[model samples]
Target: MTVYDFAKSVVYGVFKPLYRVEATGRENIPAEGGVLLCSNHIDNFDPILVGMMAPRPVYFMAKEELFKVPVLGKLVPHLNAFPVKRGMSDREALRKGLAILKEGKVLGLFPEGTRSKTGELGKGLAGAGFFALRTDAQIVPCAVIGPYKPFRKVRVVYGKPIDFTGLRQGKGSAEQATELIMSEIRKLMESSK
Candidate 1:
């Protein structure tokens, strides 16, 4: 088995019993194509949670700092995670994300840019929109509800894909796209209630 598949198996073994994750709307994910999974960040485990639930192997744009850790730095890349410098435009990271999508892989993204300390959805960054617009990849709005607490049920909902077929790539278009993506996530969160 591949390292990613093995790692996911191990994580799902523990996650299913501990958190009891429930996922819905898996049908919304495209079977094969470049697609972006835009999710709201709630905890450090959010990426793993989403990846475990997704129908396809999901790659992520993690913060650069996480890659500096001796073990995680070496391991995350094998799991399809690349590092991005937080709070600034990391062109190289963006390029990598685009390349992943262009190659028809699933790319995971937390548009909020960071985990919300209070477990509330935060404003989304334009990076997700930027990639969608640039690559013409569909964006799947995902909402992960509930805190990362043991023995509690956490819900993950994937909404319909947002298409930016003809949208221009710029500050204004990116911001608008980000807002639309966040709005879809908000709807998914409400529906999960």
Candidate 2:
């Protein structure tokens, strides 16, 4: 097996039992091709939830500052976590993200841009929508509920895939379209919870 596959397997085997990871909607994930897995951010373990549940390796965008950590910087990319500046638009990150999709891999985006302390879902960035529009990638809305605590059941739910292309067809900027996309993400999340 590839190192990435082996690492993901080892991590999932260890934590899956420890955290009692219980996820449904695995069937909802597309069996082939590239797609965006948009989710609500709660705990630091959010990406782990995706990694364990998704059948394939999921690439996530972290902040640029994370890659600056001494040894950690060297490790994050190997783990399929790349950097993005939290507040501003980083064209390079977008380019990387697009390239990942173009290469036919799954990309993960936390619509909130950061962890949600309230445990309630937050508004998502337009980037989620824009990505779907730009790549014509199917958007999969995911909801992770409860258990920032230990030994508790962590429920990860996947909602239906959304095609936002028609919603923005020639009417607005990528920014405007993204806001609308995030709104749809919010709606999907709300319905699942």
Candidate 3:
């Protein structure tokens, strides 16, 4: 098995028993194509949870700093994660993201740009929208809820794909698209209540 599959199995094996992990709306994910999974960031484990729940392999753009750590830096890339500099436009990261989509892979992204320590959804960055528009990939709005506490139930909900076909890519368009994605994520989060 690939490193990703093995790591996923190991994570799922541990997480499923320690926490009540529930996933829904997975059918909304495209079977084969370039797609973006836009999600709310709650904890560092969010990517692992989402990747475990997704129907297909999910690649994420992690912060570049994570890659500097000795062992973790060497391992994360094997599990389909690459580093992106947070708080600024990292053109290299964007190019890598676009290339992943073009190759018909599932690109996972947290539009908030960083984890929300407050447990509330934060404003989304425009990068997610820009990637969606640039690659003409469907945006799957995802909501991951619950405190990352042991024995607490964490829910990961996937919403319908947001289509941006024929949408012009520009300054205003990217902001609008980000808003739409955030709105859908909010809806999904509310539904879990």
Candidate 4:
């Protein structure tokens, strides 16, 4: 394996148990090739929870501001976390996500634009759906529950993949397609709760 992969694997493996992770339905994540992981956002550490539990490396789109820290900017990319500009199209981020898929890597994303400050689910953005449709990659729906600070049990539940190829048959706008994709994620998130 490459240096980056080694580093990420070790880091995640080391922290996997510290969070008291309890995951189920891992078979939902396909064994090979590109995949889009659609999940809900509830905390700043949500990415870590999912990434650590996943059987494979999963990339995240973090806000640009978060990358400004001297050490993180250098280390994040190594861990497969790229920056996304908040409140904007962030074409660069989208392009990077697509490229990762084209390179046969995994992309983990929360349809929600940001963390759920109110501890409730939020309407999801369409980027994850777009990436899946554009690359013909499978999407694994997931739900995460926990707050590491409370010393609580953290759980990440994986669900079956949502295939979007069927929707391509009927006439549908990008917006419609996005909603349909988010709806599937929503159902998985709810069921895992």
Candidate 5:
């Protein structure tokens, strides 16, 4: 089995029962083609939780520092993660994200660009919208709910793909697309509550 498959299997084996994690609407994610997964970030486990529940493997753009850590540096790459410099525009990161989508892989992104301190949804960065606008990838909005306290239930709700067909032709389409993406995530959050 691939490293990602083995790692995911191990993570699922551990976290699924430990955290009592549950997922819904996973089928909403397309099985093939490029996909942009936009979700609200809340905890350090958010990426792992979301990735584990996805129907397909997910590739994430993690902060550059994570890759500098000795163990995580070597491990994350095997798990389909790459580094992205936070703050300011990181063209190399953008290019990498675009390339992943072009290859028909699932690229995971946190719309807020960082975890929320209040556990509430925050304004989305334009990066997600930029990727959506630049590629024909399916933009799927997801909500990761509940606390990560041990033995606590954590719910992952994946919403339907956000339709950006006409929005792509408009001015500032990326921002508009990000808004819609966040809106759908908000709806999923409310539904879970």
Candidate 6:
């Protein structure tokens, strides 16, 4: 098995029971072709939890510093993670993201750019919208509900693929696209209430 598959199995094995995690609407994930999996970030394990429940392998763009840590740095790469310089227009990171989508892979992104301390949905950065506008990849909104406290049930809900047909043309800006993405995510979060 690939490292991603093995790691996913291991993570699912450990986190599912511990957190009593349940995933819904997994069928929303397109079985093939590139996919942009956008979600709101909560805890540090948000990425792990999302990846664990994803129907397909997901490649994430993590912060550049994460690749500098001891063992995690070396391991994250194998887990299909690459580093991106936050708080600026990191062209290299943007290029890498586009390439992943062009290759028909799932590029997971936390559109808020960082985890929310208040556990509330935050504004989405234009980066995700840029990718969406640039590629034909399916945009799938995901929401992770509940606290990370052990024994608490956490629900990871994947919403239906977004229809960006109108936004694809030269008429829509990336900021507009991002707002739409965030609205869909907000809807998902509200539905879980």
Best by lDDT: 6
**What TM-score would you give candidate 4 relative to the actual structure?**
0.88
71-153 per-residue lDDT for model 5 (tens digits): 87998898999999999899999999999999999999998998899999999999999999999999999999978988999
RMSD of each: 1.8, 2.1, 1.6, 2.2, 0.9, 0.8
For residues 1-193, write the lDDT of model 6, one tens digit per residue: 9888999999899899999999999999999999999999998898998888998989999999999999989998999999999889999999999999999999999999999999999989999899999999999999999799899999999999999999997568999999999999999999898
Which residue ranges in model 6 land beyond 4 Å of their true spot? none
Candidate 2 colliding pairs = 126-178
lDDT for position 19 in model 5 = 93
TM-score of each: 0.95, 0.88, 0.95, 0.88, 0.97, 0.98
* Model 4: residue 27 alpha-carbon error in angstroms: 1.2
Give stretches of model 2 more than 4 Å off: 168-193
The alpha-carbon lDDT assigned to residue 59 of candidate 5 equals: 98
Ranking by lDDT: 6, 5, 3, 1, 2, 4
lDDT score of model 2?
Answer: 0.78
What's the C-alpha lDDT at position 107 in model 6?
Answer: 96
As a whole number from 0 to 100, the lDDT of residue 175 in candidate 6 is 96
Q: Which is the winner by lDDT between candidate 3 and candidate 5?
A: 5
Arranged by TM-score with the best first, the candidates are: 6, 5, 3, 1, 2, 4
Q: State the number of backbone clashes in model 2.
A: 1
Give model 3 RMSD, 1 decimal. 1.6
Query: Could you tell me how far off, in angstroms, the CA of residue 50 lies in candidate 4 after the best superposition?
Result: 0.9
Top-scoring candidate (TM-score): 6
